[model samples]
Every structure is written in C-alpha cells, then in structure tokens.
Target: MKIYIEDIAKYEGQTITLQAWLYNKRSSGKLHFLQLRDGTGEIQAVVFKGNVSDEVFELSDKITQESSVEVTGTVKKHDRSKIGYEIDATDVKVIGESVDYPITPKEHGTHFLMEHRHLWLRSLRQKAILRIRHRIIKSVRDFFDNKGFTLVDAPIFTPNACEGTTNLFKVDYFDENAYLTQSGQLYMEAAAMAVGKAYCFGPTFRAEKSKTRRHLTEFWMVEPEVAFFDIYDDMDLAEEFVEYIVQEVVKHNREDLEVLERDISKLENIKRPFPRISYDEAIEILKKKGNDTEWGADFGGDEETLISEEFDKPVMIHHYPMAIKAFYMKQEGDKAACVDMIAPEGYGEIIGGGQREEDIEKLKAKIKEQGLPEEVFNWYLDVRRYGSCKHAGFGLGIERTVAWICGLHHVRETIPFPRLMDRLKP
Candidate 1:
C-alpha cells in the first residue's frame, strides 16, 4: 500500500511503499540510512542488507541527493523524529537519477541561494517556513469566514491608484494608462456595502524603489472592510483579528516554529487587548526614547520599532495627522481616524486602516486637494452618496506577519517566490 509520511502513524507496523525523493543518505558497511521526502513531509528509512536484496542495497548506495525513488518499508513509531515516525525499509527502487545537485548540505551565500530559489525550497528550513506560511494563510481565511466575511476578489489592474500614484506601477493598457492595484481596500469597501462584511485576499503590487527588509515589490495582503463600523469598532476588530491569527499559528504550527527556532514564549504572549495609543502619545514615547520626533511626522521603521518596544504585544497607534493619512479616512479636526498596528520585536506595522469618511463632499474635496484623477474616483464617491453608513476596514501584510510569527530576518523567505526591487527569477 502507498502512504504519505505525514500519515505514517495511521499505518504503523503495516508495510507500505512511499514514492519519495532521496533527500539525503549515509551508509555504514551493511546498513544504509536514507532520508526520504515526499511533498507532505520527510522521514528516515533504515535499510538493512539482510532485509533487502543486493540490487536494492546497491541502488540505495548509488543514488544521489534528490533522486526519485520508491521506498517499501514498515512504519515504526519514533520518539526523537519531528514527525514521530520512521521507516524500516524492505526494498528500494530508483526511478530517476540526480547528478550532483547544486544545493547540497554545504552552506551557500544568500545571493546564490536566491538565484537558485527554485531548488533552495527543498531545504529543511525553507520547507518549515513555507509550511508555517500555509497555516497562516489558512488561519486568515478561517478567521474571516467564521465571522461571516465574504471573500470578494478585487481586480489586479486598475485605471487609477488606490493608495497613491507615487509608488504605483503605471502600465499601458491599450493606449490608456493603468496601474497595478496597491491595495484592495477601495473595492472591498464597495463590497462591504453590498454585504455586511467583506474581505479581499490576493497579491498587491507596489512599484516602490525600496531595499528594506519589510518592503516587497509584490506581496500578498488581506484587507477586511465592514459597514456600520466606527474607528473604535475597527480598532477592537483589529486587535481581536490579530490575536486570533497569532494564537492559531501558535496552537497549530508548534513543530514548524521549533524548526525555525522561533521563541514560542514570545508568540504565546501575543494574547488579546493589545496596547492602543494615539499618534501624539506615540510621538511622546519616541521623544522619550531619544528620537527627535515632532508632531505630524509619519512613523518609519525605526520609529515603529521604538513605539512597539513599549509593549510585549502588538500596539495600535490611531488618530494620525490628517496630512499624512489617506483622503478617505474620517477627519477629526487636525487628526484622521486612522490606525496602524505595530508588531513587537521591531516587526513594524502589520495592519493599517480605520473608519472611512461617509461624507461624499469631503471625499471629493480630499481627492481634488490630493491632486488625484477626479474622474476615476467618481465611482468611489458614489459609495458615500447613496445610503452611506459609517464603515471601516484594515489591510494586513501576509509576508511581514509571517516573518514576525516565524522570527525570520527578511520577507523574502515568507513566500514561495519573492519578487523584490532587484531579484526576480526562479
């Protein structure tokens, strides 16, 4: 019977054949130990000369790393293995040969590994990171799904920018100018009016000329918009949403976390009631930490780090200066009802949004003041024109959140293939 390593425990003590790749191997005279991996998981298959025929033993010894093979063995419970199971091989058959795989056990430079990202994913650490990323994505869908949020997909190509034109990738669309969607918030807001709550989960592009650890030329974002939601309601939802995802990851992805050497205690401390402060309060904290920060100045990576350090959990900074915020946020005198959720340990802001302006006049005036294409926003303004209620939403960066949860240094490893400002191949 054919079986997967991940489900080997269900067939323990039963003989089964595993179609796998030779992840690695070693031989000690009469015994050949083989590390086998299918897509689901990896396992150790011990081959004894007395159990298998000479042809099987010779094939096992001759096979190279990543060579495809069929390993027939009896499953045995293991106390030390990460998967909690091992295989006692009775036969081995090589289906394909791999000659001198470029990525071996030896260390390689970051650039070299990136250049070979297609093959680099076969490594144990990369696999662990990707696995945890899978769990995070699933957690996102489940959290919103249970809360009755509709999964509304937004367009990738837009006639105008959602955030701004400065960091947008303008492209020729049949002679008419177009740009990649930077955020799905605008479309999601419209969807929220139709449904009570709505969300969009997909890739978002930003033609940003940035080389920072937090920046990605193209990344995935999950934006949730809700009708009849105020700034305080939005903040409350953000905190609960963040706490749910973090706890889900911690509860389900413990083994992957161990593989990444993440500090589990830190993740466990990501419980609810995250600290919520105002923009003025955040500036005060920054100034007390020796930063020459002044009012109305937007927070960057360094400033976000300083503010987040004040708490062990994620911190929400709301009521940003109106000048620095987007045009659609509800105005509160000199401040806009906007919020940014900064993660602890210097991960920076993972969630950004707040209550949107319900006044059509204010939306149109802000669009004109920002010098945006007024014609393109006519549809957006229509949302406020007809039966508009107080609405709010937030967008969370998947790559950055994964990096923070896994304690990764860069955002590149969070995705299967990272598209950065410079590197984009394999």
Candidate 2:
C-alpha cells in the first residue's frame, strides 16, 4: 500500500510504498540510509546489503540529494529517529535525479539563501516557518469568524493613502494617479457601519526606505473594525486577538515550534489584560532606562525594543501625541485617542489602532490640517455626516506577528516571498 511519511505510524511493521524525494543520503559500506520527505513529513529509509537485490542497492547508492524516488519498505517505530518512524527498504525505483543542488546542509550566506528562496523553501527550517505561518493565517480567520466579523476584502489599489502620502507606491489608474493601499482601516470603517463588524485580510504596500529587520515593503495585514467600540474596547480586543493567535499557534503547531526551537513558555504566558501604560509613561520608562527618546517623538525600533523588554507579554501603550498620529484619529483634548501594542521580546509593534474621528467638521479640519486632498476624503467624511458612531479598529502586521510567534529574528522569513527595501526578486 502507498502511504505518506506522516502516516507511516499507522502501517507499522507493514511494507508500504512511499513516493518521495531523497532529502539527504548517507552510506556505510553496504548499508544505505536515505532521508526521504514527501512534503507532509520526513522519514528515514534504510537499505540493508543482503536483504535487497543488487539492482535495488545499486539504485540506492546512485541516489543523490533531492532526487525523486519511489521507496518500498516496511515501516517500523524507531525512537532514535527524529520523526519516530523509519522504513527498511526492500526495493528502490529512481523516478528522477537531481544533481548539483545549490542548497546543502552546510551554512550559506543570507543573501545567497534569499536569492535561492524558491529552492530554499524545501529546507527544513523554511518548511517549519511556512507551516507556522499557515496556522497563523487559519487562526486569524477562525478567531474573527467566530466573533461574527464579516470578511470584507479591501481593494489593493486605493485612491488615497490611509497612513501617509509619502510612503505610497504610486500607480496610474487609467489617466488618474492611484497608490497602493497602506492600510484597509478607512474602508473597513465604512464596512463596519454597514455590517456592524468587519475585517479585511489582504496585502498592504508601503514605499518605506527602511531596511530594518521589521520593515517590509509589501506585507499582509489583518484589520478589524467595529462600530460603537471605544478605545478601551479596542485595546481589550487587541489583547484577546493576540492571545488567541499565540495560543492557537502553540497548540496546533507544536511540532513546527519545536523544529524552530522556539521557547513555547513565552507564548504560553500570553494572557488577557496585557500590561497597559500611557505613551507618556513609556517615555518615562525609557528615560529611566537611560534611552534618549523624547516625549512627542515617534518611537523607533530601538525605542520600541526597550519598552517591550519591560513586560513578559505583549504591552499596550495608549494615548500618543496627536501630532504624531494619523489625522483621522479621535482626539482627547490634546492627545490622539489611539494605542500601539508592542509584542514581547523586542518584536516591536504588531498592532496600531485607535478610535476614529466621528465629528464631521473635526474630521474635515484634521484632513485639511494633514494637507490630505479634501476631494479624496469627501467619501470618508460622508461616514461622519451620515451616521458615524464610536468606531475603533486595529491593523496587525501578519509577517511581524508570525515572526514573533515563531521566535524569528527577521520578518522576511515569515513570508513565503518577501518584498523589502532592497529585495524584490526570488
């Protein structure tokens, strides 16, 4: 019977055929040990000299790394094996041979590996990270779907920038100039009013020149917008949302986490009511820690790292200066009524959200103050003029969140294909 590596445990002590690729191979005199992977999982296939025909042994000897082969062997439990199962091969069929594979067991430079990312994804580490990413995406949809948030997809080509005009990737829409969307928050707000609660999960583009480990020119974001939800409610929702993703990844992707060598304890400690502090308080903490960050200045990567180090779980920093925030954020006298959630262990900010401006005149004034084209925002202003309520939402960077969960140092590895400041190709 034909079986997969992952299902080998069920057919223990029974001969089965596995059509897989030779991941790696080593031989000792007359015995050969072939590492085979079939995408689902990997297993060790052993070929004994006297037990198999000369043709089978000869075929096994000629098998190179990453060669496609059909292996017929008896499955057996081997506690010594990394995957806890192995196959004693009685027959071997060479389907296809791959020679001169670029990626080897030895270490390679980051640029070299990234340049060969198409082939590099077949590596074990990349496989684990991609699996974790899949689980994260599934958990995101499940969490929002269970909460009754309609999946409203926002457009990729937007008329105006939601974050800022400077970091927009300009494109020509017919005769008019259009820009790639920085966020779906504005459209999601409109959807929320129409559907009560709405979320958009799609790619967002930015033309930032930053080459930091956290910055990506193109990345996926999941934004949830809810009408009648206050800033505090938004923070609470953020905490719950983050905790849910972390816990789900931990529970479902435990083996992948083990493969990545991530410390599961850190993820387990993530709970609700995450450490909450005001932006002023964060600045003070940074000052006490001898950082040079000033009160109204936007926090940089290093500043965010310093602040996140204070808490074991994700931390919430609220009420930033109005001058530094987006123009449409609801203002509380002198400050923007918004919040930024910083992930633990120097993951930086994974979420940014706040209450949106509900007053039509104040929204118009802020839009004008930000020097945004009023004609473009006329549709947004219609939300307030029609029947805007206390609305709140947040955008979670999918790559950053996956990196944090997988305990990765760079966000580039979290996505299958990454678009960075200096990287646009495979």
Could you tally the backbone clashes for each prediction?
Answer: 0, 0
What value does the lDDT take at residue 154 in candidate 2?
Answer: 95
Using all chains and alpha carbons, the TM-scores for the candidates as numbered come to 0.97, 0.98
Q: Quick one: best lDDT, which candidate?
A: 2
In angstroms, the error of model 1 at 3 is 0.4
lDDT of 2 by residue, 1-426 (tens): 457788888999998999999988999999999999999999999999998999899889988888899988899889999878899999999899898999988999999999999999999889999999999899999999999999999999998887664589999899999999999999999999999999999999999899889989999999999999999999999999999999999899999999999999999999887999999999999999999887889998899999999999999999999999888899998799899999999999999999998998898888888888889888888888888798999999999999999999999999999999999997
Give the alpha carbon lDDT tens digit for every residue of 90-174 in model 1.
9988899899898988889999999989999988899888988998899999999999999999999998788664588888999
What residue pairs are clashing in model 1? Answer: none
List residue ranges in candidate 1 displaced over 4 A.
77-84
C-alpha positional error of residue 369 in candidate 2 after TM-score superposition, expressed in Å: 1.0
